[model samples]
Target: MEERPGRFLGVDPGAVRVGLALSDDDARVALPFDTVKREKNDKAAARQVRSVLEAAEVPCAALAGVVVGLPLRLDGSEGEAARRVRRFAEALELTLGVPLHFVDERLSTVAVERTLRTLNVPRAEQRRVVDQAAAALLLQAFLDARGQETWPEADSDEAVAEGPSPGDEPAPAGPRGRERRAGARPRRKRR
Candidate 1:
């Protein structure tokens, strides 16, 4: 049998930046890793993210999955930013050939900014670290929920990066129609 990978990668994508995070060997905790410049093209950006994943303690070949921040609007509708992320995430999923999932990330950066300010982090420092911090926050949330086997309703995506568009068939759900990305622990079977 093939060994399931041991680490999860987190991604926080922005117009000008892409934050990367890596989980502990057990995929139980996440820590900020690096911030890559978002190139004008998404394939280039995926290449940069691939570089970061390869640099982690666990290489891309050992990746369990990727959890990407899906920037949904406050109203729970996806906007331009969400679409943009889906594009980069799709390209990245192809580049890495790993399982892909999306976590609703409305206000995640705002929350991180508030914490940084409370900690008295200077504006310049906050700008440098906020995205990575947000990635860690999102990844941690996912890991915690996965541990409990009850993912938060608001944090999960109805469809992952390969979501359905208007006039399209509903996107496929994770194993057995339960919500999550591929490679996640399957929900316990019903009696």
Candidate 2:
């Protein structure tokens, strides 16, 4: 292999929009790039990704691999959406001649939504920004789990520079919190 920066491309594939994210020039951090609309003809979406790769000056031979978001059910089961994503990834691998990987995207959308909400983004405007944000979340999650590079922990700089996103509600703190509060319900008086 040419062994360039080894930058990886992260994809959050959707029926209507395919979000694209890229690792840094040094392949150190993955950041959201763009969201390409998937019309009746998916060729349009592929073209958009090609443009992004070209604009970024991504070395065709240097791509370490492409990471795709795998949507899993609450019990970690793959559904139709997940299958579609996998199919898309496979097509990319064959077409682009690059290795492909998958990362669990169980709650990536939720995470992105929480981020937007924390930043005080407006609800009506969220549709325009959610895909890219989801892409960033998906890529960052993959990088973190792989332990492949030293991605910056600070999300502010990357996200802010890209642009503010409109998000959704934050997820509950954690399972422990949910459990702790599970029994704290209103007490009923004896009738």
TM-scores, each model vs. reference: 0.74, 0.68
lDDT of 2 at 139: 81
Count: clashes, candidate 2: 1
Which lDDT values do the candidates have, in the order given? 0.86, 0.74
By summed lDDT, which 10 consecutive residues of candidate 1 come out lowest?
151-160
**Candidate 2, 20-58: lDDT as tens digits:** 888875655888777778754445555567667777777
Backbone clash count for every predicted candidate, in the order shown: 0, 1
Compared with the true structure, the alpha-carbon lDDT of candidate 2 equals 0.74
Tell me the spans in candidate 2 whose CA falls farther than 4 Å from its real position.
Answer: 1-5, 41-44, 148-191
Best by lDDT: 1
Question: What's the residue-level lDDT of 123 in candidate 1?
Answer: 100
| TM-score, candidate number 1 | 0.74
